[model samples]
Target: MIRSYRLLSLLVLALFALEPLQAQLMNKGTIKFEVTDVQTNNPDMQQMIGSMKGMAQTLQFDGAQQQMTVDMMGGLMRINTFWTGANSTVETYMDMMGQKIKTIMSNEDVEKMRKESEAMIKSEDIKYDKSVTKKILGKDCYKAYYETDANGQKFSMEMYVTEDIKVPNSFLQNLNQIELKGTPLMWIMDAGMMKMTFMATDISKDLGSDFFKKPEGAYQEMSMEQLKQMGMGGQIGF
Candidate 1:
């Protein structure tokens, strides 16, 4: 009987040990990422970046749909993006300089925009390497690289992504028209003169349906075409 009790105790402890690991793989949670590093040679830009350091991005996902919020220019510009795989639609709400603008696009619209924005970039431009691997929050991650030319300027980025966080493939339009197999816990962006590293700082499961609600209030509705007409195409994302 004592031996049986010992075995049962060990079993209980083992199950307890696996609980957190199981939670990590569950496709529901909020990942808070912070701008951990900034590389720039401009003194004025450094001061600007210093203030932007307080800026952080939050991504909330629950397998079916996802919402990402990004703050730019020390919160002078805020972009909130919501995508639902069920309806295959994306809604972007931008709050900047006292102007509230909202835009909704269907999957077809997104693909069309993807084509125009990706005239110089294509899916083949992204490369993934399994040999390059690391650990973020105890999950396996691999390296991937993407490069493209923005008009005449060159853009490049590297990501350390993991398959542990399962999100819908339709939600993959954010990474420059390329589909990444997993969520990126760490990524480095190289934009010629400035470089920035975004790292996931915390993950929490304290989310609900209410968290994904559309923005309320007097947000002026705008179509994707009108947004581009204003030359603020880069201010929002799907």
Candidate 2:
């Protein structure tokens, strides 16, 4: 379960790691994606989770406001993260057992995490192959390939990038680490026996302002460490 959680987190990060280039070419729009397929190498996990399809995530970028929101939903897990250039806040809601729990990471917490991650950053080689071209969601894209080792585990990635649209490079370090270029319209990640693909289904310009705001209500807020403990304890329950 812990491994699965980590894989899912990586998947989300890969799907939204866009960096800014020229400001004039920046496109402000919302991209909706669906998890088209999922499979793992572990037979035990295969028996437990079966197929992971129909999971949905949305990425909204407002170039004028310099803000973005990512909302990912799968079964009983819902994660909403808001990014404002340099800082971010994450609100994760989980339905574990019969209890509904929520975890919030304020901007200060996210800044601390950023510092810690920077201190641990290491150099890794990434190779890109742009031999294939395809049209995804009406946009022309070229396929690029790369591989990396994260936390001693190796993973390979196939990404479809386009030169037509440019996005802000808020997470420039992450993009440089992965060695990705252009805009990624679709991404497929393979780690061990686990494989998942996220493809954009639609792009629209009118994402309402309310979509990025934090919800107003009661939720049992917890720290990042507590959330990790719950996640490891199988309290994710998804």
Candidate 3:
């Protein structure tokens, strides 16, 4: 009887050990941001900050599927991201404003981008070691500096990450209509600004597959230059 009891206890312990792993597998969350211009404070400039539907922006992560979807400008940017121990892969896509562009990269691609961006850093070397003080969402934030060299020009980059907020299921919760505070992923280039910020409203997780599908019917496929001539270049993916 003691041996049987020990076996049962072992089974229970095994189940307990697997619980955390299971939770990690199912971990998912959504992050939303309210976009505003720190310099101009003009609400209209906020629209030009990046592609977003009004002032609302959102990003959703599904840990189990290793996928994330960023919703902006009434369009979905799906990214297939997988992290293994320390390595990762991210595939980005945009289907909005009558345009579609997909970029897929593995850990190697990340390293390549890092190397290419080294020249843009203020240090002259590939190393980045500068931090800026800022306030986000009423909380203090440390903004890291980086640089990217594109088209023979160097551009400064700033990013912010926080450790204060922790939610078990951020995606499943109601996030919309909440004034969240956080610095978003932003990249400003010569052509325009590229940013990813959270929305102030929570959307139903029941987003249909069609939300990511491209629109049918006849549509004009214009080159970037052509779109610029037609004054629709910025409206499409930038």
Best-matching candidate per lDDT: 1
Instruction: Tell me the whole-model lDDT of each prediction, alpha carbons only.
Output: 0.63, 0.55, 0.33
TM-score against native, each model: 0.76, 0.70, 0.39
Residue 119 displacement in candidate 3 (angstroms): 3.6
Candidate 1 local lDDT, 48-162, one digit each (tens): 5564464577778776777777765567666677777687677777676567778787878856766664665555677989999989887788998887776777668788888
lDDT string for model 3 (1-238, tens) is 3222222222111110000011222134454444443232456545344333243334444432223344433533222222222354434343444345443446665455345433333233222222665455443445544445658644443444233432222121111111223323331212233333332334223333333233344444433355346443233211
Q: How close is candidate 1 to the true structure, as a TM-score?
A: 0.76
What's the lDDT for residue 147 in model 3?
49
Question: Comparing candidate 2 with candidate 3, which one achieves the higher lDDT?
Answer: 2
lDDT of 1 at 167: 46
- Residue 164, model 1, lDDT: 78
For candidate 2, report its TM-score: 0.70
The residue pairs in collision within model 1 are: none
